[model samples]
Target: MTEVSRTRPTEIGLPGPTPRDMLRSMRFISREPLAFLGRMAAEHGDTVAFPIPGPPVLLVNDPADVQRVLRTGGRSWSKQTVQYAAFARVTGPGLLAADGPTWLAHRRVAAPAFHHERIEALGGLVGEAVDDAVAARLRTPAFASGDVADLAELCHHVGLDVVGRTLFSVDLTGQAAELLRTTGSAAELVVRQGRSLVSTLAWAPTPTNLRLLAARRRLARATAGLVAQRRDAVGPGAASYGDDLLGLLLDSDLTDEQVGDELVTMVIAGHETVASALSWTLMLLAEHPAAQDRLRAEVAAAGEVSFLRHREALPFTRAVVDEALRLFPPAWVVSRRAREDDHLAGRDVPAGTLAIISPWLVQRRAEDWPDPEAFDPGRFADGATQRPAYLPFGAGPRLCIGRELALAEMVVVLARLLGEFRVSLPPGYVRPAPETLAAVQPEGGMPLVVTRA
Candidate 1:
């Protein structure tokens, strides 16, 4: 590690390693971003400057500094970086990739659909999807015949189905397989762009670009078809098709392209990240049987629990989810580009600097979390006070809009699965390395053995 000043002084020059440090940092970040960020914070301090080829790049690990950049200094930063530019190809100007007034407009139109009450009302939809997966996939002979099933893939399918039903009131179980393949391909393309400085060349007529274009077209057609169907169904003299998100967008003044962008954004961002979170939660539970047993007991006590109605009663189960998010946040890294010069934690930062915040690193700081690596759900028990340090879903105006939905889905799935079956890693199983494709996910998939509890 290159030696640099570790102290934080008001208005001090940015401190980071030399140019050589940038090359090593890039290599490690490409392979293991969570580890790389954690190591940087540990060796340096909460804020570490890195000498990239272009403008200054700072890795911020302190919660206070993170809040300043994401919450207070939000106006000075924008998502117009290479990271979100890649997402815009697929998501367009939707809430995920949009910034400034466009983002605010989109958020206003879509926020009502994700209200706490509205999301709770969609709990039944989530439960239905999980039940279908349990019956048709998890409990089937193929999964029960001593052959391990990839739980990550299973969750992804169920997540996509849930989002389709809840967002558009359409059942996508039949199209789940194809949608998963297309979305995965598109996601890999975006991840590549995020890692490459030549990301602007993504529009080139290369084979990869062609494949990405084709994938985007397919997804657009599917979403556009749903929007048209809903519009036609609500024409004059037609009965209302209920107020799903599609119905809301159709009733709004958003153009077809804008509507399509939001649809694709919801489909990709809504499901994939939740699936990864659930997968990692399950993996953590398998690794720590005590926590798993406690969760199972909590679920059993609340028989036929409704996530919305009885979530307060299932404290242990909720804590397990919270702890899992802390350890392995699906959206592990959040990046922003400074639109103007700013000060973070009293350190002077120049304009056009890249600010990187890793929830994986901040949550694991020894100062905030005792025995940070231990899988202890009790840390989030009732009256526990670590809110400022916890940011699994991010913070500020740009915080994830689907946070409530994701939490509900995870809680419902975990309760149902752990209540019905015992999940464990297969013998000789090795934890897969984490990959930052779209979201932080296991490189291959999480394969676990399941049997009746």
Candidate 2:
């Protein structure tokens, strides 16, 4: 009874863990989610149908199937799942959690700002913001005095600065600490909501939901201030609101509430997601000297950090980024609810079944990544990242619109930082445990020692 099986359930015709296994898994699911999910999939075959109270919850692990569910088309699969419904509590019906035709139209209007070429054009602005954030956030007296720095914290600050400058044309660094804290609190509450069927009544004045209410209120105010500030800066009757992403949104026909929702999405996604990626990449680099040296050397040889100009020249540095993303994808698990009866992975999934497609599982599959645990950048040296098993950004219609911007932002931050700072783990350093949040974040923060390279 303790052993997991690959055999299909006679009733449903799908393979999964038994009810007993589910009961025992609760002890570690909160702490070792990735390990737990990986083992369940490996033992139970591609789709592991977990027995949740309300509906059938399946972890879709097969690469082809994960893509298929995501690309299922029309209203067949939606963000009505627990995870996204919880996320929408904080983000409103923004791009991250929105669905249907209106979401499609919003995507079209916002797509141009995230285009590869447009992100490339923002490279200089990005580089400036990175330098400014590093100077202000990382070069503190503590770091100057030879104390180890919580580099993950600094990455959040820097990521916020760059996102604000390049996308919104605002200076959010002054408010970074408070804003980051508010967003972080909201993310934790959202995760809690996703895990429990009881928490789905978001309107209930339960303590957890009450705290989420506070966080969302603060976020709404912050978003309004951003919109109002942009209006004031551009002034009335100006020819344009300026060409930044925020400007495009402001010029669009989206209502005030719609604009606020989109801004909240960008603020959280842009800062928290990129910060998590940069933090993990730095942690990986600090552990691999040869790889770090090669990346730094590439930046040194190129004489520039702009991806627009040096993307072709810095293959290894970019590979380091790709490999790091492979190891620690920010948006780890994407969930969807079946809108109607449908077949999936050779099984009849009933309408409203909760299906989770995790990037963590897909990226770490041994079939796609040989020695999936190793931090080898050479796997991507060829610069081909269109692998089906890799959905660091979720697949199909809901694929992250900010993919180009996130990649460019990461390259700029890593290239510029490694260009000057020699980063390494301090003596007696222990790797932090990964926590599932808005991203796969280091439990505490990634602390590392750095000096001039």
Candidate 3:
């Protein structure tokens, strides 16, 4: 990970794992990130600092401190950490990976497409996508054959379809399989790169690198094709096409390559992330039948699950999605490179040090979350999903721009699906372990027994 830490900081000033523990941390992070992070916080408290030679590595597990690191750091903190480096291989310089002025510039061009009123208008669009998903995918003959359905795959298709209409103003069902495959492949490859840095060598022709390259090319091709088709249909040099992400980008000053990168970023961030959230929520609902039934009961009215209706309609369903995000939090861990010395949880962190804050850790802190390990949607029952220590979509300056869109999508999906199907875990089925790829998803996808509601 490249950072501006040109010089090493003197003296380790914070509580953390010993040198021996650091070595073991490497193994644990590769094997089980959540467990390793939990162990670290349990042993060293919220603001644990690693005694590394270069800069300093600190774990800011406290919620308030996590907020400070993300919100107050401003330009003092950069996203040039190891995590973003791996993700940038596939995302290029898109908004997710971009920083400082570049991020601001890209966000400016992209913001209009995701404006409040615009996303609010997405209710009908999201409804259409979910309606199609239910009819075309879930209501098929195979699902009726008593075979468990992989709702993760279905969620991906639902997410892609929603993105297609909302972002590109067209249906993406035909390309859903390829789009899902490439993005999923890229996410897995990113995890490989994160685990062992050698996978980062894209030119080496290593198996993971070769596959990653192919995935990137495929994603790039998909984005390019969509952008080209949209632009051509709109006629050359035309400023306005329609009210969508592609339309907004076509009017921006960004180059074609930059436009493609942004589109790919949105698809991955907007689709894969949302799919993971929905999948995890479904997994939780599957395990807790009462919650599932309650969600179904809440959304009994077809007119209740509108996009921006989160405040009014389907409150229990909203709480279910909120608690699911609190537990799974698709983007489990986010990192930052401190440009200068800073403080988190009252501990001094040297400049260039990597600050790792996992929403999984902070949100799960028993202090903030009583009985943190339990799966309870009652935590957010008051129609309040935001508060201290909940960094699902993150906090402050770099909070996900698609936060509202993602929430809207997840609520619509949960409300509609629960209203139609009754899902339960297969008999004697082992709960799939959480696998951290592009997102923390159920290993092998979420397969559940589905029956009509």
Candidate 4:
């Protein structure tokens, strides 16, 4: 009997996918990953290998296999050098890219800020932000020739405003331009410099590496400024918003510097994912007006007072967001490393192997979904799915802490936007689907027509 160990092959049973073929597939997958993965799974079966160098890459398509790898089999995996190598450029040791007890500890400390009860309390802030965004949207040329604006960008502003009020008690409306520039530049640096091992080398400092360092410094400065303002706001006998993320962290064991890193991490996590989700939802709604119509009717029935206040009453709006997340999850791919030799979907996995389980592929599998490409929010009616697949916030114990908050934010924005305005994608929009190291975002921007309903 052969005993599997660390030195043994980490993954097996993936018929025969060469490292080169896997790399070539990666290029095409980068463009249309969902379709590409569907083709690969069909051609190569359940388990397929991608050519990522260092170790063999395993692409798990089965939901059961995905569950095994993420939960029961997670101990055999790690966040590893690959994911951290890039994200560490900005977040440092924050939970997103950290591994082991450190990540767990940070998650524990940060958990209070996003708990369901705490999130429900933030509805007031979310509502205020939505109101501001709506005002700005109405100011657009909807009265004249009906100019199209970027719904995703509008959502980003909304997310930023929400994060600002709820996290730091600072309104980001005035600082949004600078904030956007800093985050956008940081993302570009990660994409360019964080991809290769040579760039991440600490011993040799290159121009790219220097740029990454500078980006982090700028981000820290901005974060620190916000923190200082909040810390000063702690007055005598004043009721503090200690439950908000920033307030919670301010009371945590993390130092101001550490707090800054985590704050930036939260800002990006709190904004980008929700913003992309909102953008994708609008895009899908534009493509499927019937779903939008149903949502509008539901919101109207729920009451036109305000969407964020009536979150509990708008089931159809929630369904629309859920379906959008299924079809186009912002965090579409889950990547991890095997710490020990393991078997996935009857395939033997060697230690140190990188595994990618994609919701983008799983949610729309023909076996799991009927007419998978079609936009149908009715499929997710009543907060249920036809299959065990569809994990927009991820799965297992490591599921996203901000899941409820993101959902609430999305529902509020969707209900409000659809309640007051009719949406349509601009002619020949042809925007490329999102490509990023973290959340998905359309390549250029998402432009949509907004007319008073």
Candidate 5:
């Protein structure tokens, strides 16, 4: 670990590390990214430099510094990192993978679908999806027998179904399982490739890469099929597009390939992150019975309709979601490559340098969060303090467009689930370690015993 210096450098300073240390850091980053970044921030202060080959890699943990890199200096940076390069294989030149004009154009076309009015109207769809999942679980012998259920798996199904219904006006519950597995495998491959020293491994015809290729092909075919179906439904003389995101993209100037990429990106982004957030929130609530009891009581009193109608009145429920996001942010790390020379928190950052801002580290900083490790929903009772520091969905022009929908899904699904069942971790069960694949997810599924409330 790099030691913290007593005097902060006024200009950009690279904490020179021996070649051995640089190799060790790379290994740590690849093997355990969360631990490596946490240790770096703890031992080397908010800003730490790694003497890696090519451009310097810096991890900025300071909230101000993170803001500078993500917002103020955003125009001077691009998503041209090796990490994003690996992501582009599966995501293509979609909004998540694209930068500059391409990103702006996609964002503009798809923006209206995620508007507050549209999202609010989709509440009923989200509610129906959650109810369907609950009904399916209740039909299973596991619920009747009182056997442990994997809430994480259940949430993924619900998330996928919700995303499908809301975005494409189609129910994907039938294909959710396959989609989840394929996307997971492809995303894990990308993460591995991103961390590898050899960038070509991502494109190599290795078994993993082959699987990723197959997954991409499958996803593209699935999306293209949906696009065709929607187009046919509209008829030749009818409007080219509907109000949905898929409709907007098809109606836009983007090519069919670009439309497919954006659809795939939305499916993966829309479902996975929300599912991860819901899973973690359940795990946290299960661990904290008192909070669970309060939430249950609140849900019972308010009812399902109120989750959307009277959202602001349910501060505690929202806080629980916020706190969970703080501890287990799905998009744990945001990576960017400097496009031009920039200064970050009084330090000079050279063009082409890789800058990483980890919400997991920033949110958990002791200075920003008191008793950072503890699950305290009260911290968010009054809403997020230090806005830049609490970047679960990110900040700036590139902030996640689907954040509102994600939050609404989590709150509604959690309310419906907790209102009906009492969730408890299985006895002698070990907590799953956090793993970064597409998003921060539990290593093993979150297995918990669920009983009717």
Candidate 6:
């Protein structure tokens, strides 16, 4: 066997980075998540082991291995305790981090909001938000831009608006900017705390905890206020949106705290991912004019870019969104732990071991994707490649309950933007990778130059 083949399962594995290098990697994750992960993948092949954590934590980059751990053999794995603990503190048993019966319950409750038919119905709302966002950008004279519109922020606002209007019957557009700041800060704080084994010891009298508590209070207040308003408006029929997520959740016997948790989790998880996907779609389109032309033609042929209409007309737009997601998956890494002793992709995983399945790596693995780095949406169209390798929304029973909603939202937003705006990267702009908290967002936000198409 080759040296790499023989040493693949070693505990320390490869020449691991030193303490300084480790710190640098951590900082890079905080500043440039996607790039740091890509660097790690390059240095170590499909499965790389890190020295931290009680046992060696394996970063699985191969798609087949990813599927084995996340779906095909999920029974052997569970969400990392670290994540569940941190997320539970804020969400109180919400779906994003919950496991077992609790997660299953939350999934059932929130599933309706994301049903394909229901999500399709919400297309008009998505189209309207995207159109308004694009129009806001268009107000800036073409080429007269100095920070015209932050696509990241715009998409965040669009997502918040969609969730509010469709789910809670609220107008969150006004609060979008504030919510963005508050949630982003809270998520970063949570991640910092979760990363350390000694975090709980330091939680007392620490500024991070103090800030985290304050942020949680603010988020809780906002969520409670919205829930109260929705409850009063609906009257006893709390969980009753024909297909709204909140209504289905209300149908369950979960406490108000649980409701608050789920609402905030959805607010944070749902929109940001789709927004990132949309932002990357724009970035990819600007980088490849040919793909953009094909998208524009496909969208133009569709009827009006209206959400309610043109369901069957925009395959290229959907393809572009899917491709962008595959390249820069917003939820880049999924953290899980082995619930029982399990062997995955030829490695023995003891119980309580952390397993990181990253679509960011798997989707672009040299072995899985041909011309892996190329910006080609057509690869996803019909039968050009294996579909299992793509897990942007995750896989298995725990797959994102909001996947359908997210995709519909992306397609509608991209179609509208392509139809109305000539989107491109601002001149001299360098596309930054991302700093992931809850989702991967451009570090300083995506500043793009816009013009009426």
Model 2, 191-230: lDDT tens per residue? 8777653346767789988998899899889889998998
What TM value does model 6 have?
0.88
Error of 1 at 138 (Å): 2.3
True-structure RMSD, every candidate: 2.8, 2.2, 4.2, 5.2, 2.5, 4.0
- Misplaced by over 4 Å in model 6 are 1-36, 72-74, 140-148, 194-203, 236-243, 304-311, 383-386
Instruction: Estimate, for each residue in 309-360, the C-alpha lDDT of model 6 and write its tens digit.
Output: 3435676777777788888888877778888887765767777777776688
Candidate 6, residue 401: how far the Cα is off, in Å: 0.7
**Candidate 5 vs. true structure, TM-score:** 0.94
Show the lowest summed lDDT stretch of 10 residues, model 4. Answer: 1-10
Candidate 4 local lDDT, 236-331, one digit each (tens):
554653677788777777899878888888877888888888888898888878878888888888774343344458777888888889888887
Model 2 sits at a Cα RMSD from the real structure of: 2.2
How well does model 2 score by local distance difference test?
Answer: 0.83
Alpha carbon lDDT at 348, candidate 5: 76
Candidate 4, residue 36: Cα displacement in angstroms equals: 4.7
Q: What lDDT would each prediction earn against the true structure?
A: 0.81, 0.83, 0.81, 0.74, 0.83, 0.71
Residue 83 of model 6, lDDT score: 58
TM-score of each: 0.93, 0.94, 0.93, 0.88, 0.94, 0.88
Stretches of candidate 4 above 4 Å error? 1-11, 20-38, 51-54, 72-74, 140-145, 191-207, 235-241, 304-312, 385-387, 429-431
lDDT by residue (tens digit), candidate 3, 214-293: 88899889989988898789897675867788888878889889998898898888898899899989989989999988
Tens-digit lDDT track of model 1 for 1-453: 333334342224655566556564576667666676777677667888776667777888878888877885348888877888888888888888899988888888888788877877887889889999888877765666446778898899888988998888989888888888888889988887776543468657988778878889999998888878777767765454457777677667789889999999988998899899999999998888888898898888887765565548787888888888988888877788888888885766788888888888888889989999888888888725348788888888888888878887899999887888888889998987888888888889999888688
Could you give candidate 5's per-residue lDDT for residues 1-453 as a string of tens digits? Answer: 433233233225744344555565665667788997787677667877765667767888889878877785348888888888888889898988898888898999999999988888988898899999988986566566357888988898999998899999987877887788888888898888776533675556888789779989999988898888888888776666799898998889998889999989988988889989999999998899999999988877775464355357667888999999999999988788899988875667789878888899999999978899999999887865447779998888888999888887888998888888889878997889998988899888888888888
Query: What is the Å distance of residue 132 in model 3 from its true position?
Result: 2.1
Give candidate 1's whole-model lDDT. Answer: 0.81
Q: How accurate is candidate 6 locally (lDDT)?
A: 0.71
